[model samples]
Target: MLIDLSSNENPYAPSCKVAEAAIQGLEGMNRYVEPEELHMLRKALGEYCGVGTERILPGPGTGYLLERVLCGLAVGRELVVLNPAFLSCLDLAARLCKRIVRLQLKPPSFEVDWTLPASGPALVILESPNNPTGQCLISREALKSLLKNEDCLVLIDEAGYEYAGKTFMDLIPDHPNLALCRTLDKAFGLAGLRVSWLVCGDAFMKALHMENVCLCRPALRAALAALEEQRAVLEEVKGVIEERERLKAALSQLGLEVFPSEANYLLVRSPRPDLGLLLRKRGILIADLSGQWFSGYFRISIGRPEEHQALATAVEDILRTEEGFMD
Candidate 1:
């Protein structure tokens, strides 16, 4: 069996409490999710986010919320995005927006420039701790500067906030043009449930009518249980973070270029351009970003220590056989 680490998923399984809740929820599958159950979820999420229930909007996932918001607000407006952002968001912008302005983040330091040009009626979308690169690209002061333009609406995707230990949710009350998109798929070990939500500001509340949005019964139950069992989730997250550091050091020791990551994965540049293929033959699966975005670059999700050992071994073998390949 192959150890798949293409997607940035938590290597741990959901807590027992979450599993039991999902089983219990299966009993009510015949009936639609009751409004009260949805309310309970929103209320739980609001409390977890330290915001009021009115500001929270639950959905199937962050992708769904982003699509709805983009369809409603991005039409006929300039959509600004980072080049190596989430692919789905980039595709959505290409289809839904009038024009796109891609801010290309250079290597070594994938920093972002918040000083956007004065364009009328624009929508700016950014992912902090951006995908693929696994680096946080925004600052509090830079974000605040972007929000000063009343004509520009800023949407920040904090999908990896749990691992990064940073968030801008507190600014929602003050900035009418700001919104945040988050998901439980990463740190909470609930990817299969597709549980996600949006924290909307006053302007977003009026634009996206999210009152009727609902998650499936099982997903709803699992999400509630996960939120309730916060201690176990935090412990698992701590474990993953530690393993990430160890893996980064291991890969760096092998003469591979490992970039610093604030997310649950690492972006690496290998000497061999076909590193992804070489690993696949060894029954290991990792994301090769070369075809998708850059050459000789790959993204490796944090996995079990044993799995990392297997990968390191395979890489070592490749290095020995391909000596002087880069010359």
Candidate 2:
């Protein structure tokens, strides 16, 4: 059986309500998606996020919303980005922003340099439990300091929110410059549905002019159903977190250096760089970060216990074969 764990997705099935809503929404596929339906979606999302309904803008995916946010806010400004962020942010900044100033994260720990440039950039992009490294970059105090600049617009991507269980959403009401991007894809098991949102300040809401960013009718239904059954969805997130710890311990026991992660994935440094290929041959997929800044590391999405055991067995076989070659 193929166990694909490259992308960090929730392993659990979505609630029955989500499935029911998806089937129910199909009946209206012939008609154009109405405005009121989307408005209600934003309202429900607002409640879930604990922000004003007016501040939430929904799009097909977090990347789409990220593109729009960059286009709307960072187009003519100096963009300060933390390095080794989601690859798309790096790609978009180079293309869209007038000037890009990348701040390097301190090595080993991968903690961000909280010391802002003397003249802050107009935009700053941050990711919590960042991809690849799976480390949270800033502390609450550092975040407060960053927001104090007032001129800098901070876009914090909390895509791995459920696993981390810590959020700065409460900081939104006070900081006009702060915006948080969230999606149903990661923790809610709604990747196929493609619903995401940006929670921002009044100025951003006004800046975007309340554009009706298109989310398909069926996807909207799925998103709403997912929200209604958030408790169950969160329980799944808890399960992933628990399994992540167990997997980390197991990998460590096998002599792989596993990096700390607050997200639903682990950054593992394999002794053999070709380990990903060997595993892929056995129908087990993990993210090879060797091509990225992390030259010897790969990211493993948290899977069920059986998948982890399969991976461990494969690793042992590879090590034994390699030891024979050495002898």
Best by TM-score: 1
- Model 1 clash pairs are 129-136
After superposition, candidate 1 runs with Cα above 4 Å error:
323-327
RMSD of every candidate to native, in Å, equals 1.6, 2.1
Q: For residues 62-159, what per-residue lDDT tens digits would candidate 2 score against the true structure?
A: 88887888878777677877665554655777787778877765447776676766364578877787876777778889989888887788888888
Model 1 error, position 16 (Å): 1.9
Q: What is the lDDT of candidate 1?
A: 0.87
Top candidate, metric lDDT: 1
Against the hidden reference, what TM-scores do the models get? 0.96, 0.93
